[model samples]
Target: MTNPPYGTAPGGQWPPAGSPFTSPAAGPVSSQKQSRGPVIVSLIVAVLAIAVAIGAWFRTAHSDVTTQSTTAPQQFTTQQTSDANKALCDSYHKMFRSVNGAGGQTSDDPVLQQVYAINIRLATHVASDFMYDKLRENPAGSPQLASDLRDLANAYNEVLMAQLADAPKTELDPLYSNIDSADAKLVEACK
Candidate 1:
């Protein structure tokens, strides 16, 4: 049996006369070509967006550096530094007195003793941090005062660490001595 011709038109004609769907020879159909304009435009837009983002990032990074470099450190007057040092010394003295006062009130109960110890540690830490912050903010005009403040802060940090570790009095004595020496030097520098 023979198969019918594919795409047979009316009256059994393989190709209808002057039909637009198929060519007379019945080769491939002629379709319209897709436009590349939109695709090219989209690609250009994406590249431009990426370039703009990169440019903005570079500009922000440069401005940050520029701002940092242009900013100057705060300078303190001699009288201002002296007053700040005196205030800091007074605060430290008061804190030490309060700590000593608290130490005198002892409890027989282990729990109460532990609570007192924790409170004392917290007080000492707060006092140390306050002193450090004050020193940093005012920045003593005299180099000797600045050095002493640094030394005192370092000593206080060591004492705090020792206290946290539950170190014996023997281990902490040297750190306390360092603090006293620094404090004496700072007092002298302040005057």
Candidate 2:
């Protein structure tokens, strides 16, 4: 075959009039939209961090009022609980008998009303301080006994309050019956 012409190949021109080392001219662009996504994300993260820090500060600041009880409430043997029940019940029993014996029919009798209040105060003192207090310090072993004793103590206190308010003779029997029922429950629970 015959030799080809200068700066030309068999079917095309050579190099195409461009340098390989030169970069292409850049196109005009709008100023980069300050990506709002990152700014929003950063603000959200900051707010959440502040919220967590504030919650922790509040929890610590109020810790004194929320102080945990270190003392463990304790339970007792059946016999011990039974004894406690008996003590409270005995006070109620005595109060019932004494108030009944005081026996004033008229609600307007100031001396008798005063006597009722004094006896009620005494009975409340006995039940609350002597027996109920101990039971609270050491809970009953059996759930039934504990419930029964609580009922009795509450009933005893309620009766005392009623008597102090000079509940009528008509109200006396039912109040006494409540005490007896609670006491019987205590007896049955211990058994």
**Judged by TM-score, which candidate is best?**
1
Model 2: how far residue 63 lies from native, Å? 22
Error of 1 at 72 (Å): 8.8
Give the candidate number with the greatest lDDT: 1
lDDT of 2 by residue, 126-165 (tens): 5533335434444433445555665666677677767658
**How close is each model in CA RMSD to the real structure?**
23.6, 28.7
TM-score of each: 0.49, 0.39
Output the TM-score of candidate 1.
Answer: 0.49
Q: By how many angstroms RMSD does model 2 differ from the true structure?
A: 28.7
**Candidate 2 deviant stretches above 4 angstroms:** 1-121
Q: Which 10-residue span in candidate 1 carries the lowest summed lDDT? A: 60-69
TM-score of 2: 0.39
Give stretches of model 1 more than 4 Å off.
1-76, 186-191
Give the whole-model CA lDDT for all candidates, comma-separated: 0.62, 0.54
